[model samples]
Target chain A: MTWTVIGTYATAICLLIGSAFVMVGTIGLVKLKDSMTRLHAPTKVGTVGVGAVLAASIIHNFTFGYGSYHEVLIMAFLFVTAPVSANFIAKVNIHERECDTPPKPTVDEHWATLKPNGIEKMPDQPAQPSNGG
Target chain B: MIDLFNLPVGDGPGATFLAWSVAISFAVVVISQILAMVRVAVGPGSGDRILALDTMVVNAIALIVLLGISQGTSIYFEASLIIAMLGFVSTVALARFILRGDIIE
Candidate 1:
């Protein structure tokens, strides 16, 4: 049982754990209802699953001296982008139903960016009479 | 059969443990994917379907990364990147469709 062997074993175990998390996330996707709930499934899985796999790769690379942390950069990119993408899609979906208009072409500008914090704006609603009429 | 880069099958920690771990993880992923498939198939609305697809894509990317680790190859990393890029595109497209009823519009 050399150090090299032990390192590989650790990396392999990490990879497996990461993979298992991903699978659970997918199961959640199947069990949950609506687009919002489904969107949540991937976020939970992608973060930890990608993290574990990348960690495993880092360990393997360190032990074997194969590649640099370049793959890690990819993992980082995924971590940042996956959730944003999910949120974008979910937002657009919500807006479409509320507006009864076509979904906006750009979710970032039309839905995510413009959406007020906590308070929802209904475009079709008329203003209340200040005079109590 | 110990190599500087890779742990030789027998020399390092016996292939049995390594193989079993990979197998178990692989099984878990498969089962999860199956469950996702059920959701995708049974979802009541288009939005639910799209969400399921997104989750499926993420799971697929995870599987690829794990495979890369098991095989000790960088090929799977590239595939994982492609999947990541493509997943975003498909999700955006689907979301657009959900809103506008068309991808381009």
Candidate 2:
């Protein structure tokens, strides 16, 4: 039927697009110079790429009479959670690396603020030498 | 009316072949994911590893949907949904731990 052909063509198109994204992601994983750039690759490609392929499957299922919505629920779930998951992973990675430069501070800023609770200044203490004895 | 849009009346009307095409596409996604995993394993930085993990989760979701199509069942959908929910939770927990060094803080 015409619907079936339409579904096939649509699925093919989705597959092509998804594959392209996956390939790009893979290349980025290999070629990106640093952690932040690497994060962008999978987030851009992996989430949306799988989404497109899953959408195509849903269409194919509906057209073939395997039931109109067998795979739709899965598609919905993926859409809901994929981005959140990516964000989480990126955050964790940023945290674990503990790069010398904290994410919040800019290059020109002082690294840390003086605390008001610190002991009132004592007469400058003489430097003490450690005795290894 | 339904047959009006059907393809030129060849194998295009069959269900099995359509399922096969979906399977093939899913296979491609899985293979690409495995390639991503290689990066995860050899990653010189934690961020690259996390990126690979995220890619793996997405590939799993795609595989579940394709399974539903191939098997003509809704059960796989439920499993996929469960995975999605859990994956989101884990990712959030991990992220919080990374940023603040404690899940609660």
Candidate 3:
């Protein structure tokens, strides 16, 4: 009985926090201007917002149903992929010339996204030794 | 807990609080979904649209989890998980298509 009460309140708190973060994140998504700036917002939703809700689910299940950790799988998968997708989106912005071009690399003639193909050697590739086959 | 569909008030303070929180969160998430939809519709660039769509997917996942909590069941877990995976894949693919003019190559 005690654990039930505790779990219920815990779940409620988690739900509230999660919902608040999700709301804030989405608000930022709508309100922020510029594609690069817009990219900053939804990541909040991806990480903390969904994370807290998943925590609530886990707690609620343990308290009132057959407890399971399967939700963790979703959480982990989201965590792993959110940044990768975000990076891809940013890359798209760069490739499309939608966002500010990054500062010139000190060591390379062109940013990777803007680099002309084949005309210049790839910056990261080492030059072959003259004697090597 | 008060079921949103059934509208029965729960028996105790904890249940009542949880139910109310769940209801409020549902409203908030739905509002976020609408906001994201607006962004998707009006976004100036494809990146913005893609980002908004990603946000929508994340919000959908949150909505499903809330549904699970309200119904007091674990069965929805699989649905949310599949959505998460698919959403991520779709976001990456869309971005890649924009970047490279191709998804696989």
Fraction of native A-B contacts kept, per candidate: 0.54, 0.55, 0.85
The candidates' DockQ values read 0.42, 0.39, 0.65
Better of 1 and 3 by lDDT: 3
Give me the displacement of residue A79 in model 2, in angstroms. Answer: 4.2
Clashing pairs in 1: A103-B99, A103-B100
Candidate 2 docking quality: incorrect, acceptable, medium or high: acceptable
Task: Please give me the total number of clashing residue pairs in predicted model 2.
Answer: 4
Q: Across residues A31-124, which tens digit of lDDT does each residue of candidate 1 receive? A: 6655565667767677887678778777776665575676786678777777667765666657545324446656443454334334344244
TM-score of 3: 0.88
Instruction: For candidate 3, give the lDDT of residue A27.
Output: 94
Stretches of candidate 1 exceeding 4 Å from the true structure: A33-35, A92-133, B1-10, B102-105
Per residue, candidate 2 scores C-alpha lDDT tens digits across A51-130 of 67667666756665464554556556666776676666655554455334454456633322211122232223436333
For each candidate, give the interface RMSD after superposing the true interface residues on Cα.
2.9, 4.1, 1.6
Worst 10 residues of 3 chain A by lDDT: A124-133
Count clashing residue pairs in model 1: 2
Error of 3 at B73 (Å): 1.1
